[model samples]
Target: MGTKIGVIGGSGVYEIDGLQDAAWVDIDSPFGAPSDQILTGRLGGVEMAFLPRHGRGHVHSPSTVPYRANIDALKRLGVTDVISVSACGSFREEMAPGDFVIVDQFIDRTFAREKSFFGTGLVAHVSVAHPTCPRLSQACLEAARAEGIKVHDGGTYLAMEGPQFSSMAESKLYRDAWGCDVIGMTNMPEAKLAREAELCYASVAMITDYDSWHPDHGAVDISDIIATLTGNADKARALVARLPALLGPERAPCPHGCDRALEHAILTAPEKRDPAMIEKLSAVAGRVLG
Candidate 1:
């Protein structure tokens, strides 16, 4: 068997092609139901699980994506690595529509979501300063290059809390003051939770617009974004299909230390650790306790 990989689809990417024996599996997590049922199958002979970030019919808003459940569900399904494909607006002049960015850093402006797994009874604080796995990022970069796609190796992504697009003032601030490369609504709590679960995480950002900050472009529009996203979706699928071959047949430890983040993070004394919380986190933090 090959290493298990999980792909989180965003925006226009609802499904992946070339997945053999694809079957939808609804997994119940301690957090709750994931955005939707996960589809499991083989891609390039590797075991792959795909979860639509916005739900099957695109029902959930960015703020309502059930991120905790999505991460937990992927963990429960034995997902060792996760590739999040998100649609974003460019903050830089060079990152235009139809291009791909492998984000290495993030600036989270989101507030209303549950961003951690250690709550209630269990309390574990995992390090997230460097979020995405460098190993996986390298693989994604190589895959993108091999596919002849316009790709940027690394950049900072700004994650905002939004059912609404950012205002012109806000967009300008993020682009100028924040020095971010791209902006999007989701990818925060999901990336943080994946770290807490010790799962490798990386994001493939597909630029759809220049946001509201670009002087030459008009204000951010949903209709225009959708059209650009539809075209990028096909490219995203092609990039994913090439990842397994680039990553190889077996798994290797993350060079960036993403998988070992919780090594000493649990602050609660062994005797003080909440039994109820421990039970709830059994699936995710069991190795730490063991």
Candidate 2:
């Protein structure tokens, strides 16, 4: 596969200073319409696809962001790698607001969303023990650092089910007991589905506030987070520009096997698999479904 980079991020991250030939192109997926038209362009001579995670004006909430459609669309766009950038609340003081964390792990507490492309008719289990692609993440980390963004190379992200912010008790538990470094409302089904789609995935969590756990910072509030996102947005855009230069215009197979997750994961016999489900899996599991 070529080094076509797909970035699923908020509206502001896509408009870097020197993006060439940028255009938002619509993609209708079997899963559904993606969050918005994907902004397709070239940066650093690499093909880039940028989808606004929350739609153009930030319409969708966390649970309803159409995670499946977004990943499926990116896969269909011929994106060899997917990078997710989302606003998060910090659990650790050191991480702080405005820091960018290259999330290495996830504890997905989101239960209401469709977490995979395969289901009852077509079953598959892909390993997510080490979810994020290390090589891709290193590129992201390097990109952020080169832009003078405060980048933490690794951290554990706790993905919560929410349109609601975490309660104080929940925040404390995630911070003190679970050892979560940052908390976000998205990145759950998003990351999991990417693995099932066999796309190299990397998550960069931009801290917007301290989630209810900091006594000094107090509880995480949407207003503060929004204000923080203004700066985060600028930092994120700068970070995005640096990626294409670092990742280059061609790529090697993911050293971690993210590009071929379904080689042996599908346990359902081909004869037993539903034709309808197989048709829907054309873009995602095509390499194996054939």
Candidate 3:
């Protein structure tokens, strides 16, 4: 099978360009309804799928995104590579507003969302020691550079559960004490769920503000974030448009082991696994489960 790329658009980014035969297709996932109908088509002869993380018109909050269903829906659509483009607040001045960071690690502080596909009935544990897929992330970094976008090669993303921006104290702690590079509300369970689905996931964090830690910036202003997001969104689309050629229309097994994450990750013995849970996991874990 050829490579099928999936792009998850975040705040201020509702869609992408340069797709041929683009169509919004409704994909029903067993987990639940995805954030929105997926936009699928071909870009530079490579299959592509786009999903708005917040849905069209920005209907869902950060905490309300259907993380599990989103990953399942992409997996169901045969997306071999998943690219998440989200807006974030930077901790360092060098990673200023309008910059892009290819996040390679995550500190998941989100508590309310469903973070996994396996549970009581069936059990599995996938290694996330190095969260983002290196090969895919490198492709993102190169694409951004090719587009003349100031993009950092790697950084750690702190995923917080929020509809509200962080307090001064919280922002300072995450920036100084924890050494986080960029902070965002999405990407937690979304990245985790992608691993559980055995998909090669890469995160492209677009910097919008300096958070509340910067003395000059004071607090996160909606007006400021909106302005930066608007500019960053345009650059993000250009970077995405360059991906198909770099990644090519065909793919081999992931050299970093992203494609075979479930190889030795399942713990439940075949006989002991629940039939219902196994059925539910069919799409995400079918390779190892079968």
Best by lDDT: 3
| lDDT (0 to 1) per candidate | 0.89, 0.89, 0.94
Tens-digit per-residue lDDT, 1-290, candidate 1: 24788999999999989999999999998888899999999988788999999998899999999998899889889888999999999989999988999999999999999888886556778877888988898989988888898999999999999988888999989988989999998889889999999999999999999988898997988889999999899999999999878776688777777777789989888988888778778768887976
Per residue, candidate 3 scores C-alpha lDDT tens digits across 150-217 of 99989999999998889999999999999999999999999889998999999999999999999888
Q: After superposition, how far is residue 107 of candidate 1 from its true place, in Å?
A: 0.6
In candidate 3 the C-alpha lDDT for residue 162 amounts to 92
Better of 1 and 3 by lDDT: 3
Query: Between which residue pairs do clashes occur in model 1?
Result: none
Error of 2 at 174 (Å): 0.5
For candidate 2, which ten residues in a row score worst on lDDT? 10-19
Task: Report the C-alpha lDDT of model 2 over 1-290, residue by residue, as the tens digit.
Answer: 46999988863454446658978788879999988898888988999998888888889989899999999999999999898989998999899888999999999998899898988989999999999999999999988988889889899999999888899999999999999999998899888999999999999999999999899988777788888888998888888888888889989888899999999999898889999999999999988888
* Pairs in steric clash, model 3: none
- TM-scores, all candidates, are 0.97, 0.97, 0.99
Clashes of each: 0, 0, 0
Better of 2 and 3 by TM-score: 3
List the lowest-lDDT window of 10 residues for candidate 1: 119-128
Could you say which candidate leads in TM-score?
3
